[model samples]
Target: MGPEAPRHAYFVPGRIEVLGKHTDYAGGRTMVAVAERGFCLAASPRQDRRIRVCDAACGDTVEFNLDPELVPRAGHWSNYPMTVARRVARNFPGIERGADIALASDLPPAAGMSSSSAMMVATWLALAEVNALEDRPEFRENIMDLTDLAGYLGTVENGQTFGSLVGDRGVGTFGGSEDHTAILNARPGHVSQYSYCPVRFERLLPVPSGYTFAIGSSGVAAEKTGSAMEKYNRASRLLSKITELWREATGCDDRYLAAALASGPEAVGRLTQIVQHARPGEMDPKALLTRLEHFLTENEQILPAAGDALARGDLARFGELVDRSQLASEQLLGNQVPETVYLALSARSAGAVAASAFGAGFGGSVWALIEAAAADAFLDKWIQAYREQFPEQARAAVFFTTAAGPAAFRVT
Candidate 1:
């Protein structure tokens, strides 16, 4: 190792999987990219073997001795960085000669925001900067001359991150390749962008601007490396296999699909069942999409009940949809009687317009999008209602939609 020295800080964004769930692990295309929420790391090199890790939010410190011999166990978020160090060392022999790593994060665990993956990727990128490793001409540099690595470092990091987090011996990098991929940037610390197209299903190509979504959580902190993720991956893989079989049996390929989207309605429906087992509120993407579509198809009482208000030029129906969606989410999608849903319900119950769970589900938070002018009233009412229903989980965050998706920092 040269004495070039290592010292730097990086702010990396969180990733969101808007669509194409379960496809990434199968080497099939999945749409995912970093979001506004993020994690930051500040580091400086240490001459000896030790890692000084810190959590800015909670003011916690963890010092690990960079012990390669030690295997990671459950419950330690630190395992992710260690694991990245391990992989890098495997390639460059002594990449982790000596280093200090300080970490700060705002990403929520098990929120389907890829907090674990973001942390892992942030660590990898940080390591890469410190080592000043040779920049390969292509996205991934092959470890051996005989084998070529594919995709950006984030893709590789994601594969490792999810697989490591979920505990599947072989899930993410199962036959990963680097060809015809939509380019995503790998800024030293900034969020990267990827290609996003209006996925055509039954909905309009350009979704109506006024339309809003609500998300509720189960309030349970899920084990990212435990049964929940594992079950999804397993079922996802099986679905991929079935899609392959179906394609092979019939020469015609599915029209409205990428190599990944072969699992049309039936496939998504089945995936929904599997994901539901893991608790839809907690983000079984497969099942969440299934339920979302199912809502569009049936049990649309809320839309008609409350949304009909918006339709009848009546405000009450809109409020009802908000209230009704929250009730439905609590009963089906996984809002565990927390204040978020109640707040969301309050926004409608107090008469602001439509409300639903717009964030990741399972029990953490809920979202409500209402008329711009009525927003304050809605928020105030929602807060009061939420405080009454669930005293604890009553926190609110407000954000609006904009032109944001995955794109490279410097696209050629």
Candidate 2:
């Protein structure tokens, strides 16, 4: 960590899930963008295989050996950086050096703007730079492009194997690549649309001119730990169960629910029948059906239509579609809390063009689209509205405006 040590620095932005909710893991589509705020990190290589990370803001530091058997401290912020180090070591062996990383962030922790994923990405980028992981045969063979890197990083967080690279313990979430994809690939001033389970790019639509997004953090931490982790993973597990049942009922080998539904024209009807006739103790038929409905309506319908609406400058239609997404998240995905629900409704009433609670959503934040000229007034009104309703949260809530920001990159 001295001036003479070779160093690399990076900035990894947080992300907003514009349209897709709990759909990424199911091989579904989502519109996402990067937030202006994120993590800033500087890393220098260590001669020995010992990784040490210091939180510049808090002065909290964690040091660990670059070993595959590294166990993360439960409920500690270091788990994110530790998981990234362990995964890198496991995936690309023969690494003789580690890194000394110091990081600072402006993004709120656990407000569902992907603070955790951003940290993970920053950690990986630092390690990759110091150890030249990208030039390694293992890394070159596995990660072909930014999209592939995003997908692989997602596996690092979810404990899923990416191609020939193996996976071990993740940070205890069964999420997908949406956050990682946006963090790595979002275009400034435009919303990027993508589909996961293989990470495909669909299109990019400009944010309607004269408008910006107003983000309101609900002050309820949506950390993917403890009970919240169970709830978040349950949504993912339900989708997996649906795919399993679909394959069982019909002899298809579709890997995801989206693929299962796309296998035939009668797929929906057949899946509905399978759910209805499912035996006791197999899975909750009602939850499975509701989850499927949300996925179909959100991914197959609302997301694409919303993108088209934005493309055509149809603000009214776009707002309506976002409303549907919010309702579905509340009723079907069952991720929304009262605070988030209130934020979405209140944002609309406060005259946002479109609004919805976004991210892993047991309790998180909401994004409201409004004219740039009205942003200041809109935030004031929106914050006032939230304050009147949830006074306790008003002190913890954060309100800010940002245009779609740049992706993660080297800080030069």
Judged by TM-score, which candidate is best? 2
Tens-place lDDT digits, model 2, residues 245-357: 88888888999988888888998898989987877575678888888899988998999999999999899999999999999999988899999999999999999989999
Off by over 4 Å in 1: 1-6, 15-36, 65-70, 108-110, 134-219, 225-227, 230-241, 244-361, 367-377, 395-412
TM-score of each prediction: 0.55, 0.99
Q: What TM-score does candidate 2 get on C-alpha atoms?
A: 0.99
CA RMSD per model (angstroms): 9.6, 0.9
Error of model 2, residue 148, in angstroms: 0.3
- Residue 164's lDDT within candidate 1 is 23
> What's the number of clashes in each of the models?
24, 0
lDDT to native, each model: 0.43, 0.92
Q: What is the alpha-carbon lDDT for the whole of candidate 2?
A: 0.92
TM-score of candidate 1 against the unseen true structure: 0.55
